[model samples]
Structure formats: structure tokens, C-alpha cells
Target: MSAIRFEIKLHSCNDRFNNPAVRSPLVVEVDLSGPRLANDLFFVLHDDTTGRTRLSSRLTGLGLAAAVLGELMLIGRVTVELTDGWVGLALVDAAPTGDTLTQTALDHIIAEPSHRFRIWLQFLARTAYTDVAARMTADGLLHPPRGRLSRRRAPVLANTAAWPGGRLNLAIQRRQPLNLQDGVLLGLLVATSGGQLVLWDQNPTYLSASTAALPAPLQELIAQTEAAVADSVISRR
Candidate 1:
């Protein structure tokens, strides 16, 4: 396979007025509207230096799985059942989700509606990494790995990859109202170690406010992801 390159129009970050220190909304012209939450989550969690997910593969996979389900909820394809304090995913619609990977996940949920949201996370995490990578690679968000044996997907365009983090940071810092998708992205960031590395300045107020707008199931999804990541860490210790 051949390497592919893409160009992103980014305003000069060197301009004093546009400095990232000011958290100036990244002045980059990229049509990020079409991509799904999991796709943006992948880029947000991907390491620019290593071209790998910033968290352990297991944790990242679970995060990505949550992201995909969150997307389904945002699009009205899925809903959640609340039992006491337990949350389970419920398939609200069987229509095509428009993305095959997301649709596949939806199918799994539809096939087994009895699974807990946490179990769904583990099941989806089993293939979320590669499934999402192939989805992005097909969409051209990922550059093909340099080596035949490597599955690492560096961004095709750095600015495009950086846009997710910039958007989240600006939203939190500026106290801008977040849409459900950004809310889920923010939740996933908090669920994984990505929060410390990406958004070093954690704002509990912003998190509480943002999460308040999310549905109960989605909120529980983030909590389950956090617990799963913590369990992974404990097992590693």
C-alpha cells in the first residue's frame, strides 16, 4: 500500500493573538461534522508521537466501545433501561446507523438485549480498536501504517486530529454549551487517562454541568468505563 497525505488549512498558531495558551478556538478549517463520535474519540486518544492509543489497548477499546454506543444514543438508535442503579442498553431502533461499525455494534445489542451496559462494553471492546480503525481508514481519517505488520494509524492530517481536543478544551474553558456528542466525548475523556494527558486542567463544575445534560444511560456508560479502566489498572498492579 502507498502512503497518503492530506492538507489542513490552519491559521498561523504563531500569531500572538491566536496562541493556544489563550485557548483560542483552533482556527482550522476542517469539515469534522460528518465523522462519528467514535472516530473523533479515536483521534483524540491517539498519540501523535507514538501513533498509538494513549491508554492501554484494553482501556482504549472499552472507551471506544462506549463512544460508539453513545453515538447510537445521540442518533436515536439506542436507549437505556434503568433498574434501581443498574443501567442496560436497549435498542430503540433497528434502522441503519449509516456507519457499518456502529451498525454492527447496534446489531450486537439488538441480538442480545439482556446484556448489561458494562458487559456490552467488554464485549464491544474486544474489537472496538480495529473496527474503529478500519472505519476511519475507510473514511480517510487514518493514514495506512508504514509497516505491513503495524496497525497503528497516525492521523492523515495533524490539524484534523487536533481539532477534537481543541474543540473540547474551548467548550470547557469558554463555558460554551455542549451538544450531546461533545458531552459524550468529554465523558469518554474523563473515563480514561486521556483526561490528565489531554485536558490537564480538569473542571469538576464543567464536568458536572456537562454530564447533567446527558441521559442516565450515557452517564452510567461513562461510569462503567471508568470502573473498567480502574479494574484494568488494578489487575496490572
Candidate 2:
């Protein structure tokens, strides 16, 4: 199967983020066409090597829910409304998403358009992590570890799950222009405060710009995710 490729060209700019080499219309071709956005986000958040995330389940679940919302928005099934300081969501298309999880989410949004974004995030976070993990297991991206030791040895697990993180890490390190999916990946990382794990040891310049490149809806989603997680942390303290 031929993988889909995206070519992103960076025009000359005076921003401190762009290195000299990338200033002259640099073109970057990247193949970020693996799993869908939500699946890829779950794999990146779950530590395949350790079978756990460094962050709390609360944060990871919120991030996963946000990612799924992002996927829905990308396919025109949903939209985030940011009017003034208020943020909420609405269903764009009543057509079935062809996936149960997202379809259910859309249904909820359709049923009650008044619920704020944070409310939906908290509600979905209740199950997004486990649900996505189960989906990945069914799709062959993860193998249910049989025991403590099987965490590392499970077939079709770690390597596949780790690929998304490694791929995004390399993109930041190499200062490549990120596609929409990759941009969202990085944004979600920073949103979940997991940037230090993957964005660590890279040039902060282009990496910052890459995330800032996300479209309006996505940028709003990440911003809301960050705020929601912050509130959770504060309440815990």
C-alpha cells in the first residue's frame, strides 16, 4: 500500500524560529498517514515501554478525548464555537461517523448543544483512555499484556505504539514543517503538559511554531484542554 504523503513548504520569514537553511522556501515531505488522529494520540500518550503514562489517568483521558474531538472536527462532523470567552461544541453533520465512539459523542453534542467544552471533556475523559486502548488492541496496534512481564514482550505492541512519539520527536528535532496531524499531535502533547517527554532536547524555536500552526478549531481545543487540565490539577491540590 502506498502511503499518503504531505509536502509542506516554509516561506522566508524573519521569525527567530526559522533556521537559516529553512528560510529559503524549504520544502518538507512527510508521511504522517498511519492511524487516525485519535488512535495515534492514544498510542503516543501510552508508554508502550512501561505500560503507563508519566502523567495521571485524568490528564491522559482528557487528552485522548480532546484528540477524538479533533478528529471529528477535521472530518467536518463537529465544530468548536469560541465566541468571546465562551467555548462550546456543536454537531456539523448528523451523518454517522461509521465509528461507534465518535458517533456516540456526536449524538451527545446533538442532543445537548448547550454543554460547555470543558463539560464534554470531563465526561469523555471518563472512558477515552480505556476505550482507545481497546480499539488499538482490536486494530493490532496493541497487544493486551498478559502479565507484569508481558508489558514489554507483547506482540505488535510497544514498537507500533512508540512509532508515533518517535516520529513526532524526530520531526521537531529536524525542524521539519508539520502536517495537520503532526501539528495536532504536538499541540496535544503541550496541552497535556507532556511536551517535556517528547519535545525535550529539541530546538524550541520551530517546535513552538509547529504547534502554533494548528488551525483555529484545533488551537481552541488544545487551549481548552490545557485549561481543563489546569483546573483538575488545582482542584487536586
Candidate 3:
């Protein structure tokens, strides 16, 4: 599939912190919208204090790729199709999602509908990392490393630590009900098997309950992604 073109623009915002002090704005519009999976994945993968990410590169790659699929499913651009008892992903729409990475992924699937979820998952996992980082960079969320062996820098949440994943995890940990979007987000994270890594310390039973509570559609999607990740892992082994 061809590349999905990303549009970046400058956006101005005045507030920097909770102190109400106005600071010079350095915001850039990444043109991201509506529960961006890449952003959420980046947030989960990056650690704030040590200025590093805990997830292995392979896990991070697959997790981000699965997040893209979850995003597509959430936006109604794709669905799982059962054909002769065999399940596969089917594209619902071929239109661009404005986010280049998403559109490119859709384009790939549209170009080859016969490809199973595992293939797409592996493809995206290997290829989408650069675009994901690029999006975060455009958003001004990633910070340059102060001093490091590797030049890779950690991402900083602009306003608060409560990113979408954080919020969803928080609600689940607190035994609060999840809305549809949150449910889907949580399902995607669970699929990545990076939920524990993302949320830090949490009870296994509560996590299980949270997963169990997701809607059927989301649960199916999660199952598909988890299978895809497993297949990718096995193929590498």
C-alpha cells in the first residue's frame, strides 16, 4: 500500500500548567482526533520519571499496531467477518481517517482483503513505529533526551498524567463503570498484554473483571488482536 500523507500545522495555546500562568505556546497540530490509538500507545510505552520506555521494542511495535486496528474498529471503518467459520478483518470504508498512519493501514487492507489479521499486525508492528513517533513529535509531546546513550527521547503529556489510557485504567481500578470509548480503549490495551505495564501495579482480579465487562464487539476485537499478537510472536520463534 502507498503512504498516507500526514498534515501538520501550528496550533497556539496559552496555558501551560495549573498555576494559571501564561507561557509561550509551542503547540503543533498533529491533526489527531477521537481516541488516537498511537497517542495512547505512546503514552503507555513511555515512562516519565526515568525518561524511558519499559516495553520491549517488539511488544511496543505490536501493541501500537494492535492499537491502530482497535482505532479502526472503534471508528466503524473496519469489522471482523466470519466466512465459512473462519474469521478475518473486513474493511467497512476505504476513506481516509485524516491521520496518515490510519489511512495507510486501511489502504493496505483494502488492497488485500484476503490477508489475515496476523499479517497486518506484523506489518504494522514493524512499520508503524516511525509514523507514530512522528505524530507525537508533531504534537510537541515528545521531549529531547537530556543525556543518553541512545538518542531516543521520552514523551511528556502536555497538561496532565491522566492520558486516555490512564483515565480508563484509573476508572477500572477504582471499580467505576466504563463508557463505550473507554471500554474499547481498555480492550485494546488488554489485547496488547501491556495493560499491566501501562497502568503499573494493579490487582489481577480487577483487571480480569474489567476485561470481562467489555461489550461483545470490543471483546471480539480484543480476542482478534491478541490472536494476531500471538501469531506474530510464534512466527518470530
- The model with the greatest lDDT is 1
lDDT score of residue 168 within candidate 3: 69
1-237 per-residue lDDT for model 1 (tens digits) = 222122212223222223343322212122235567888889889875456778789888988988988777666677666544466776656788667888888888888888777888889889999998898888888887889998798888888888898899988888888876788889898888788888856899988889766645556667778898888789889
| Pairs that clash in candidate 1 | none
Q: Per-residue lDDT tens digits of candidate 2, residues 1-237?
A: 323322223322323224554333223232334577888777676676656665788888999999888777765666666434567785556778777778888888899888889999999999987677776677777678677654322327668778888888887677778777778878888888787765545567776687667555566778889999999999999
**Ranking 2 against 3 by lDDT, winner:** 2
TM-score of 3: 0.72
Error of 1 at 124 (Å): 0.7
lDDT (C-alpha) at residue 195 in model 2? 76
For residues 42-142, write the lDDT of model 3, one tens digit per residue. 67666654436666677777777877776676565676654444555776666677777788888888888887666777788886666677677677777
In model 2, the runs with Cα more than 4 Å from the true position are 1-33, 83-85, 145-155
Candidates' TM-scores? 0.81, 0.79, 0.72
